[model samples]
Every structure is written in C-alpha cells, then in structure tokens.
Target: MKKRDILFFSAAFVLALLFGCGNGSSQHSFALGDSTFMLDNKPYQIISGEIHYPRVPREAWRARMKMAKAMGLNTIGTYVFWNLHEPEKGKFDFSGNNDIAAFVKIAKEEGLWVILRPSPYVCAEWEFGGYPYWLQNEKGLEVRSREEKYLSEYKKYINEVGKQLAPLQVNHGGNIIMVQVENEYGSYGADKVYLEMNRKMFVDAGFDGLLYTCDPEKDIVKGHLAGLMPAINGQDNPAKVKQAVRNLNEGKGPFFIAEWYPAWFDWWGTPHHKVPASQYTGKLDTVLQAGISINMYMFHGGSTRGFMNGANFRDTIPFEPQISSYDYDAPLDEAGNATDKFMKFRAVIARHLPKGEKLPDVPAAKPSMALNAITFDKEIGIFDYVGPGKVNENPLTFEDMNQAYGYMIYQTKVTGGAKTELKINGLRDYGIVFIDGVRKGILDRRLGQESMMLKVPAGTHSLEIFVENMGRINFGPNLLKNKKGIVGEVTFGGKVLKSWTMFSLPFDKVETSKIKETKSAKQTPVLKLASFEVAKPLDTYLDFRKWGKGVVWVNGHNLGKYWSIGPQQTVYLPAEWLKKGKNEIVILELNKPEINQLSSLEQPILDQMSDNK
Candidate 1:
C-alpha cells in the first residue's frame, strides 16, 4: 500500500518551490518514501506507458499523449535515444522529432507526469542500443563500463540532456517526476561500482530527485543500488513483482513495474507478434488490485523508421534483424490508432481509477488513404553515381571507414573466364555480388553462407559486392562490436583477394535529380523513383510486398528499408511528412528491379508473411 507523506528531500522541495514561483506555474512536490510515493503530501499512483519521441512524428506528439490519457495513463515513460539526439561525435540534434524536451512538455500539457530515461545506452531494440554509431570509432573505449574514455564522452551528452530537461522536473514546476539510471544494466553485467558511477553522473547533471534502477526479476539483485529505489521489469505476477521489489528495497511497499510487455516485437522472417487483450487485461487488473505502479512497455509502438531498427545476434540465437515497423502490437497501433487491446486495457484501467475520475474519450482514428499503384519508371545507375572510392590493401569495415548505415560497395579486379570459388571471410550482414555490373549471387550473414562460385568473362573484371548494414546488434555481449560491411578478407580460388576500392554509400540523403532514363536493369542495382500528387495528404502504407530488397525515401525523408522477407511488407508513411501538392518517392533497389508497381494502402499489411526463404 502507498502512504502519502511530507517531502523526502526538503532542500530539493524548497528549491522546486523557488523555481516554480519564478516561472509563475503552480509547483508540485514528488518524493520517494520508504513505503509509498508522495505527491504534495499525498499518495500518488503512476500509471505510465513508454513512448519514444523519435518513433512518433513531432506533429503527432500531443495526439499520442492524449491517447495515453484516454487509455487511463497518469504518466508517460520515455527513453531519450542518445543516437537519435547525437548522431555525430561532437554535434547534437534536438530539433524536429529529436526534440525530447518538446515531447516531455507536451506530456505535461496532456496532464501526464514524465519518467525520463536518458540512456547513454538504452536497449529498446534500437540500433547499437541507442549508443551513437560514432562511439565505435573512439580509441580504447569500452561501453556500459567505467572506462575513462567512455565515461568522458558520456558526460558531455548527459550534461546536454540535463541542460535541456533537468529544469522541467516535477520539483521545478514541471511534470517530470522520476529519472531512470542506465537502462536495464543487470541484463548485461553486474558492476555496482559502474552503476554507482552512472548514478553520480545523473546527480551531477541535476537529476537529484527520485533516482532509480530497473531490471528484470532475476537481475534486480545484481543491478540493485542500496541508495536508490529498485524497480522490476517483465514480471507479470502481481504479488511476486511486489514481493521481489519489497524485499530488495529495504522493506519499501510502493512497487513499480518498469517494463510490462503486452506483446513482443517482430523481426524479418518471422510472423507478426500479436497479443490478445484478454490474455493480459487480467494481469493488468491484478497489478491494479495490488496497488502496484506499472508502466506498459509500449502503450504505443511506432515505426522504427529509416535504418534505426535494431537486430539480435548471439551464440545461442542466429542473426535476426528487427523489421521496419516497430508496431509492438500495443494498445495503440503503429500509426497511433486504437486497437482491440486499447478498448480492453482502457476498461480494465477505468475500473481502478480514483472516485469521481474517469478516463477521457478515445481520440478519433487518424485518416488513412489508399491509392493506385505508383509505378517507378525512371532509373539511375547506382554504380555510375558512386562518386569515388577509398583505396585499401585490405577490406575496411563500416566503422573503420567512418561509415554507419546503408550499403558499402567493395570493388576490386579479379581474374575471370574460369570457375573460381569466391569466399568472404567476414561479411557482416547481407550483400549482392556483381562482376562488371552483372549480378552473380548473394551472401547473407544471417544464413551463414560465405562462399559462392562465380565465373566472369576473360581478362581483368571488376569484382563488386554491395554490403547492406541490416542493423547493429541491440542486445547482449555481441553489441560491443557490431561493425558492418566486410570485417575480414575476401578470397577467390583459396587465394587472398586484395587491392580494394571501398565506396561508403550511407545514402544519408538521396540525390536523384540527375537521373538518366534506362531501358531496363534486370541484372544490376538501380535507383527507382516515382512521383504522385495529393490534394490532401493523409497517412498511408507504402505496400512493398511486390518490391524486392531496398531502402525507401519519400520527398527526401527516409522511410527505411524493405525486404522480400516476411512480417513487414509495408512502410508507414505519415501525413505529417506529406504535402498538399506533389510528392516524390525514391528507392535504392539492390537486387533485380521486379517492382513494376506497388500501391499505397489505407491499412498496414504487417502480418503478410512470405515464403521467400
């Protein structure tokens, strides 16, 4: 049971009053107690749902928060993805969808308390676990540890996050009540000293109010800190979840479930994961009946747009990359619409609301459009526009060459006219083989296939392999070194292949204005494009089941990658990025251009599994 009491940190409360008075906004006090959480000397129950700012568009932030409240959420949980905020080494991006402060502010506007999980490393199945790709290039840097170089880089970014969000804390006249320490660290390692150091970093960055660490049931003991509150994640047993945290929290009573999953995420080559609401609403009821403070892992799981989705790989499991749609099948769909789960969860929550308080009306469904097939006729030869290549005696990994996402073209001269067994020692993810602009075979790291036999015309022929970085490993021990492209040597006829010209084509921005019309590209890679007009823009799904493997862009905004593989056959195109006039769509097709036409659907085709294997 929760107990409403006086302030736990008197000094911080007084400071909050001062700050709040300065801003002319009514201030609120939130404190952690031995048995209950106190909000203004009264017990406060936090019913939160995790939502990422980067996943949802900037224009739809308020609408999403409204949806959360309508579903009976009192607070919102969010992870500030470091990679999305700071893509480069020294440069930082907090504008547009990366504007986390804006997201939090909107949450407050919608009457929701904020739980800021500003992660130096957040394993939300995000690329590199939300660690910036540039971190891989740092010399002698070890992640999620107390390594000097690693901590030093982290301090800068954490301070920047503090500068943006700390003042908006609940104590300081804003709705931010709790801030989490290094996300789910015990799932990876047990280093109390390292975690303590991380906690201190948060304090120095001005997150001195209500700090906590959350981990799985088995890991709570290992990741627990004696000084801060310990929260459990992934535990469904209400009584067990309460007891586990109570025993470890020095006899505290207010239990918090950090990540309660209603459903799971899907990867390529798997069926879409859907959890029936009836299966989990009873558990939600049990948690509320026990007075446990809980947060849904994803009240809404939006799209993992562009190359931001993550992958899973370890000794136990094979290389499995996450699909483009992050739509975790939560109460809110990927496009931010209510589902059957939403109605059921809302009913369960409505029964537990305080007297005289009722859940708001669910928002109207956002509009969606279905249009005719948008044919892509114009083609651009990718090889001709590959600009230049860096010469190297050996193959350069994606990180070594200072590249992150997209394809890396490795070109070299090879003896032809004879059947030679070609082998690549370290193909990171997936690649398309070509000899003098003609398709030969494919090498996929997921399938563990490295060697393929090829025979080209006589004389020296250009050997080219287009390697696509599916996504970096987001969990487990393998994530420390998720370098894309070729990590080892390429050999033919059992002889080491050398003298490479590496082309780093991340395609951060696709420039297709200078395209030349081609008759056809049945055997090589090509840039596919199409243009369409809309009097009024609305949300639509770019149905890509007919398309082969490639990355997509609409009006220069990256929509992310697509494959012939299962689970994800369409990319979510938001109306926010659309316009009232003409819009252009671009695709970088790596394989055969079999896509003569593809339609924009009114609804997503997420469960359309293919037997492409």
Candidate 2:
C-alpha cells in the first residue's frame, strides 16, 4: 500500500474510535416502521411495566423497578401526574416523591428502558384525574380542549416536563425510547385536531423520540395519527390485536400492547376485586408466543395517599369517590410484594427468552406490623371549641373556608319560635344537623333534598351542621368547579339563619400529631389513638366494621377511609410503613363511642363485615 494511503487509514480509524464506532457497533436510534420496535434498524422487544411515581414512595422506587426487572420486564412505563408535580398552576415540585427525573436515571443505571407518559390530564382515577383543582377555577377554562386558556396552561406543563425529560431520550444516549401523546383521547372525543396539537407540542418542546398514541383497539381509528404508531391497550388476543393494528394502519409496522390489564383497581365501600392468576398467565403466554411486545397496565399499583383518589359518577345518581389504595391486583401489590400472578408471569416470560437470557431474582417483600389501640378521654364540644369571636356571617363554602381538601364544620343560631318544619335549602352533600346537643336530622346530597322536621324549644338555640366533602365528581359535565359545603341557601322553617362559625379540618401531619384530648365542656368526642408492638411486621387492616365512617392514619400514612356502610372491608397497610418495635394508629370516626374500638383481622374488612352484618 502507498505511504499516504496507510496514514489516511490510520487517521480514519482514530476518528471512528473517538465517535464511538471503532468496534463496528454503532449508537442506536429509536424509529417506527422497524421490526420489533427497532432502534437503529435492529430488532427489539419491550417488556414494560407501568408504575406511577406519585403513587409509590421515593425510597421504594428502586426496589419497585428491581421487582419489575425481576418479572422479566426490560422497560418501565410511568404517568407523570401533572397535579402532583404542579399542585398549584405556577408552583412546581421536583423534589421528594415528585423527583421523576431521578427515577428515570435510576432506571437507566439498572439497565432498563423507559417510556414517558406525561399527561397534563392523566385519568388514572387520581384526584381530578391528575389535573390540578386550581385549573378548574380558571374562568371558562375547558379541559382536554382547543380552548385558549386550557391550551396555554397545557403548554406550560408540557414545556416544564419536556425540559426535564428531553435529554433522556434514546437519541440522547438515555433509555427513554418513546413518548405517548394525550392518553386515550378518542374514547372521550374524536377531536383529531386536539390530538395533533398535543403531538406537535411534544415535538416543539424538543422531544425528538418516536411519539405514539395508546388507546383500546376500537378507538384507535379515531385516536391514532396518520404518521405515528398506534399501540393497542387491554387486548389479550394476539392475532386479533395484530389484525386490528394492521387494519388501522395498513400493516406498516410492529404491533405493541401498551396497556394489558393484569388486574383492576378498587374503590372504597366496594368488594376487593381479584383476577385469577391462571387467566393472566394464559393470556400473556399467548401474546408472547406470537412474538408480540407488551406492557402491563401496572406492574405495581401504589397508594393514592391523602385526598388524591378520583371518583366515578356512572351508575348511581351522584358521584362516588375512589379509595386511596390503588392496589390494582397487578403482579406487584401496593406494598411492592410479588403476588401469585407475578411468579406465573415471570415463568412465562422466562420460557420465551432467547438462549442465555435469564431474569433476576425477585426481592423479598417488606415487613409490616400490627399496632395496639391507644385510648383517650373526650372533653371539648365541637362548637364551643372554636376560638373566641372568629365566626363568619354566612356558612362558608369549602373553598371560601380555605379548606381546598377535606371536611368542614358550620355552626349557626336559630332564633325563631319552636318550628316543626325545618329546611336546609341548598345542602351540597351529606350533612348532619344537631340542635342544642341532640341529633336533629340527616341531609344527603344523593337524594338532592335537605329538609328535616325538628322539635325545637323556642328562642336562641345552637344549630350545628357538619358536612363532609365526598370525592369530587371525576367524569362528565359536572366535573367543572366541584365546590364542597353548602353551595346555595340554608333556611330553617320559613326564615333563614345567619352569623355562622366555620371550622376547617384539612388534616395535616403536624395537626394530626398535636391532636389534643377533647375538652369535657364540649360535646363532640376527640379522635382516639392506640399503639401496640408486634413480634414481626404483618400486613393488616384496622377493621372499621364496628365503627362509623372516617379516616385512618397508621405511622402518619393515610390508609384511606372505612365506613360502617356495606362495601369495602379492608384498607391496605403496606409493611414498609410499620416499625417492628412500635407503631402508632389513629382513627377519626365520624360518629363515635358505640363503635369506637378497632380490631386487626386476617381477612379483608369488606368480607368480614359482610359475614358479621
């Protein structure tokens, strides 16, 4: 060879090495229309598991991701809840549990791929379906629409999230391969323009990764974009799913199941639901056998915590709230423990892996503890306990009371002569009215009526009304500005009552810890506390069967509500929250004394209550 040719070849080799191609293996780039989710034109299959960051504790994230990997999943899919990250419109939180960028980085370090599903509107059955309540306060702001106000806010959220995740895409040497546009938009409406607008926003924000739409097969035609890939959701039949994809797209690219439901989510006052493990095993086997790629709807469903659970208003006349535990019967339980379903799914995936492929070992489930009861004496009356002269003129709405989240109390004085016909003109939801220290009547929003006949002794008598803000209306036309407490007017007999005193009980960790014993002079009972030590941690529910409705907090974590009403039996207590030496348990039962005590039972509270009642 010529001397010049040899020098040129050596220089070219050095350049190739500097650019990361000296070994002849090139950097990968994710693209649609390639076989099996091809990146850089090489075949790949994504075994993805869905886990929401806000639902799981930050400390438990790595373990949960390890759990997914151990289940033979190579990818993790998550919904970035807009409401959680940005509780207020302008304010944003990326620290603590909202550290999604950290979570993704951890996934990369653990050798796992990622799919980012950041929805300014994620209907994960979360509070307001993951939309901040403040958005509803904007005048004439239409959600999931082309309205200017909604679009402006949506752009703000998209830009913020994009800034956090754009550099993490596959093209940027990170694990994120694809980004999903608006979740299941077709099921809600066939507004193609709105869908395109969302897609353009993602691209404009500098997310160059392949974008796609995930919707049930039937809705794909209306939801999917012409150039982008369409992933099917919840369909188990591989052949039918492939055919559906082909029909929708003229057989252009690889088929993917973006959301395969391993199990369903539960609501408070509803039976604990479980889908047989055997059924899921068979379904997953069939899909993998056909060489199709898939992602579990939730490999691990975590808790909604606090007042974040969304409600549905479909069957009944009014809206019903969702329970806090999002334990969707997935392969991974709320506590991150592997169920029988997990083992079966793992075995199935292992059987299909190429030669030399092996899954990691599953992590051991965390510990849980059962606590002993702590009892306290009642002293203060609910009305008399109010601070001196801090009352308002009219009953304050939940918002006006600065109580954006929980229960509120309204007290007023009735000054008319003994009136038999007592009426509360506009009661928002459920309310219990007490005259002088005796229960007068119950007003339910379900019936949309609030008139009660009371035996009143003429002249000045204290009238106390307690109202609970049930879960907000999650779907349909009523979703706009769901304000709790009384919305309209309150009348007693023929005359209206004024000069009201309002108390806000937006329970916080500090307030819960400083709870004081009720002052005896007052009538309402103080919430009780109890503690007990167990030899080892065990998952158990603080049985609310014998108690009236209210909230429960164990080790400062809200375990959701337990009502004496027929339905939900057990509230989930993750072993992670309990300490072996000692654990504290507190209950805020609505009506007290008669059913004050709680017991720990092996069976779910719903079943046990059903059997006993």
Candidate 3:
C-alpha cells in the first residue's frame, strides 16, 4: 500500500473507536432534532454523494450506487428531471432510466440512504432546467413564480412524482430520509409565497420525511423555510458553513452542506473544469471533523446523453451552452470509473466512517475496446426530406408551433430587390441562411449575428433559413426568454417577410432508415451513414473530432450532439447500446465535416481543444 493508504487506515482505526458502527438498530426513524437529525432517536450524520438516474445508463445504477458505498458514503442524492419524465405534458414515463422508484430501491439494495429532488424546476445543467418544454405552450405559465398556470402544472407534476417516489421515503419503510423543496429559490426570487407553495406541494404530494432547502450562503435565510433545515451550497469553509447554517436554523441543530463542490461542470467552449483533491480535502477534513453532514454535488457524473444538455446565457455572457458530456471531473468520472481523486477522497471518507466500519474495496473499472475506423461515404441530403409545413404570416417559435426540440426550417419567397440587409428579429441559437438553394452565409446566435447583407438578381427566389435549437438557457433570470427557433419576424430591405412555411424537424421523428442512401451529398445538410461489424461489443467512445457539428445515432440510439468547438472531442458509446453483429451509425452532419469517417476510442479524449475554437 502507498504511504497515503497506510495513514488513512491508521486514522480510520482511531475514528472507529470514537464514532460507533452504522445507524445502530435497523428500525428506521428519521426526524429533525434541535440541532441534529435523529435516526431512531439517535443523532445521525448523512454522508452522501450525488448521482442522477437519467444521466447514468439504467444498466449501471446499481454499480454506481455500490461504488458510492465503497467511497465511504452511506447515502445517495439524486434529482428527478421533470422534462424527462413528462416529455409531452400529459404523457409520463417512469419506466427505464426514468424509473425513480426502481432507482431508489436499488440504492436501498446497495445499503444506501436516498435524497430525492423531484421537481417542477431542478436547474440542473439540463434542458429548460427540468421544466417540460410543453409547459411554455400553456398560456400565462410563469415558472419559479406564483403564476396560476405554472403552479397548476407544477402541482400536477410533483404529485405524479410523489406517486412514484413518495412511498419510498424512510417513514414509509424505505431508505429515503430527506426530500428537498424547490431547488434554489433564493437566487431566483424572494417570493416567500412561492417558496411556501413549493413546501406545501411536496408535503401534499406525500414526501413526509425531513424537507430541506438549499441555496448559496447569501440566499440561505431568504431561500429556506421556517420549519425546514436550511442547507448551504458552494461554501466549504467550515466556519462559514456553520455560521450560515446557524443563521438559518436560528442557531439550532442539523447543519448540512447540501452541495459540496469537489469539481465543476464543463461548458461547450470552456476548458474541462477540474478541482485538485488537495485543494478541497483540508476543508473537507475540517467539516467532517466538526461532525457536519455533507453531500458531494456529484460523486458520479454520467454522460448528459441526448440533446437534453443545457446552455447558459445572459445580457453579458451571450451564449455558452454545455457539452453533451456531464463528466463534472468528479470522483467517479463520466465512464463511471474511479479516479485518483476518488481514492484520495475515499481515504478521507474512510477516516470519518462509523466505528468498526470499513469502506468496501473499490469496484474495478469496466472493460473498453478500440475499434477500427468507420467510413460513412453513403449519404442522404436533409433538404431532400423537408416534410409538409405550417404556413403563417410570420415564422412561429418552436413552442408556438407545438414542437419542442431539434431543427426548424423557415422558408419564404423573397421578391427580387437591390442589395439589401436581411435581418431576423429573433434568430435563436444558430441558423444556416440559404437563398435559391445555395448556401449564402450562416446566422449564429453565439456570434450575436442577426443580420447579413443580401444581394439578389431580378427574379422571385426562395429564402430559407435552417435554424437549430442549440439548447435552452438552464440558469439565471434569462430562462424565461429561452424559446427555440425564430421568435419574431424576418425582414428584407426594411420590409417584413410574409407567408412563411415552417417545418419542425425534431430528427428523432424523422425516418432516417426509410431515406435511401445517395451517391452525392447536397449543398444543404447531409445525413451520413456508417454500417460496421463487431465480433464482440464493449464500451467505447465514438470519436467526433473530425465531424463539424451534428447529432449521432448508433444503432437507433441518439448519442446526442457534438460541436467542433473544443473541450469535448468524443461521445461515450456504452456496450449496452451496441450489438454483436452489424451495427448502424447515423449522423446528421449540419456543416460538412472534412472527414466522413468515425472511430471508436479505448479512452475518452474529453479535454482536447478544437483548433477552430
């Protein structure tokens, strides 16, 4: 063993004598005491790590929880994404990865306590911040506020969530001990009524365990409820953490660090965020020594998976969308493998374990394979399959047209005119401008471009703009303004363009298998196909360094979007999504990539920068 391991074992032996073994008797009872949480009437400290069920593959939930336990954590914390469960409003999906009950049961099976944050708004780096996209279509809906429509929808959603997970709470013969109310209301608004509404909603829906609220140190008093525990986020300094907790609980007991950031999340253009273990272990040691409960924000950050990864924007930071990977550079990496940080933290956690308790041996990393390069010479043009569209005086936003995600095409006839400036009032995210079927230029929302000069010959011509909904703004006051597609009118030569036909191409709805392969790629976007054979399938990372910007589908499973802009160069392709025989890979290449081939990598290249960036 290394010197660190020897030191950890010695410390563990000493602490074991001080703190007693496990939650004493198994007859479960958890409640908020004057200053500490009482489990079976005895003080209990929650040692938890965060992981989202939807983010990790359903196949790996048990493994991830087991790993959490081995890391010396006794509890698991997770956020239930609202948009994922009810993707289409009335429709609800609790099956597969969205199965909250099963996820909780698995945590119980792994001997881990649970904390649920099922929400109307989670503000996770997720699409629309966990609010269903369809909610925007509802008239007078204002989220994170007391707007009747929003609250009404919020009630229904949370109640449904209660039905799925409420029965699993500790009071109901399960391991779930605490449930959070409204993610971080203090940073958003100071509406005490709205905060109270969220509290009642959780209770009314059946979460009877200790209900707590979490916020940044500044917002603790403002964001927390009168009766519930006020847990602080981000602040790791032991003294400040205790002070903030005291300020909220009126100098009472049961202080918790709801979200301790060991590392940070990555954005599309930013460097992969990482925090050195040495940087935080000292503060962690102090906090643990003080007997304060802490939950690391992400013990394991699985892949963001689909187009569901979110973006960040404001009046200042125009557009900085998140990458597909939600690696977070955490103790458990994106691939669910333990890192050096994992061991260092595990050693620290071992020192704090209950008396006569020892951390489990770290789980072995899963197998991975590097495959031969794949060629996708066969192609089908995206423009070839422009479906029937809705015609209106002006273009309708994705929400207005009753469509949620993916691309939109707004086409209109532009009358011949002299050199004039063509402008779009609300050109959202990104767009590719085309006149008479030839690519004119690009209108990128990230670049803050809304207008481009247009000079046309003397004849009526088609003006089409292909708009891609990069992602919705997930954080800050600007979330309300995040409607995908063109929200306003398009104009030419100072005159409003008229009678536009807009098509909603969600891509998932598009029948790519039906489209026949073509010899020549079109001027517009192309759908490239790669069919390869695998003798034995294993977990792999699909290299997207050569591809420009597009979504990839492997054997009908959408692996999400990838941009040439750096920081993430590959997409994680788990073996579960692969087949033993021939497998198909479909890519909707927006901008033509220089390479029409794809490769499988044994290791992920998450930190590589795109030269273009």
Best by TM-score: 1
User: What's the residue-level lDDT of 570 in candidate 1?
Assistant: 86
Per-model TM-score versus the true fold: 0.95, 0.85, 0.94
lDDT for every model?
0.86, 0.74, 0.84
- Ten residues in sequence with the least summed lDDT for candidate 3: 17-26
Task: For candidate 3, report its TM-score.
Answer: 0.94
Q: Candidate 2: where is the Cα deviation over 4 Å? A: 1-27, 376-396, 415-429, 441-453, 494-501, 510-514, 518-525, 529-541, 578-585, 593-613
> How do the residues 479-580 of candidate 1 rate in per-residue lDDT, one tens digit apiece?
777888999989988889889999988889877875657546556677877888888989999887777788889988888778878788889999999988
Regions more than 4 Å wrong, model 3: 1-26
Cα lDDT of model 2 by residue, 1-613, tens digit: 9999999999988866543321122355877653367867767777889998878878778889889889999889998888777777699888888888988887876777889888566778777767777776778888888999999998988888888888878787667888899887777778888888998999988787888888888888877877778889888798878887887666755889999998887664467677889978888888888878888988888777777777776645565666666778889877788989999999999998878989988888765544464343432334443434337777777766545566667778887466566676656567877887676667766555578887788788988787877666665556665767877677877777788888776665424444455433333524556666766767666666666667778888877766665366557775666777877777665666335456665434443234332
lDDT of 2 at 473: 64
Question: Model 3: per-residue lDDT, tens digit, 1-613?
Answer: 9999999999978765432223322358899877678888898888899999988888888889888988889898999898888889789899987898999887876788898887567888898898888888887788898899988888988889999988878787777899999888888888888888888999999987889899998887778888888899998787888888887777876778999989888887767887788987788888888888999988898888767888888676688788888888899988889988889888888888889988889989988998889987577776776778999987899998878789989999988768878999988888998888778888888778999998887789999899999889888898788898999888899899999999888876447664576555357877787788888988899888877888888888788788778688888988878899999888888887335778878998888777552
Candidate 1: what lDDT? 0.86
How do the candidates rank by TM-score, highest first?
Answer: 1, 3, 2
Better TM-score candidate (1, 2): 1
Which residue ranges in model 1 land beyond 4 Å of their true spot? 1-25
Lowest summed lDDT over 10 consecutive residues: which window, candidate 1?
17-26
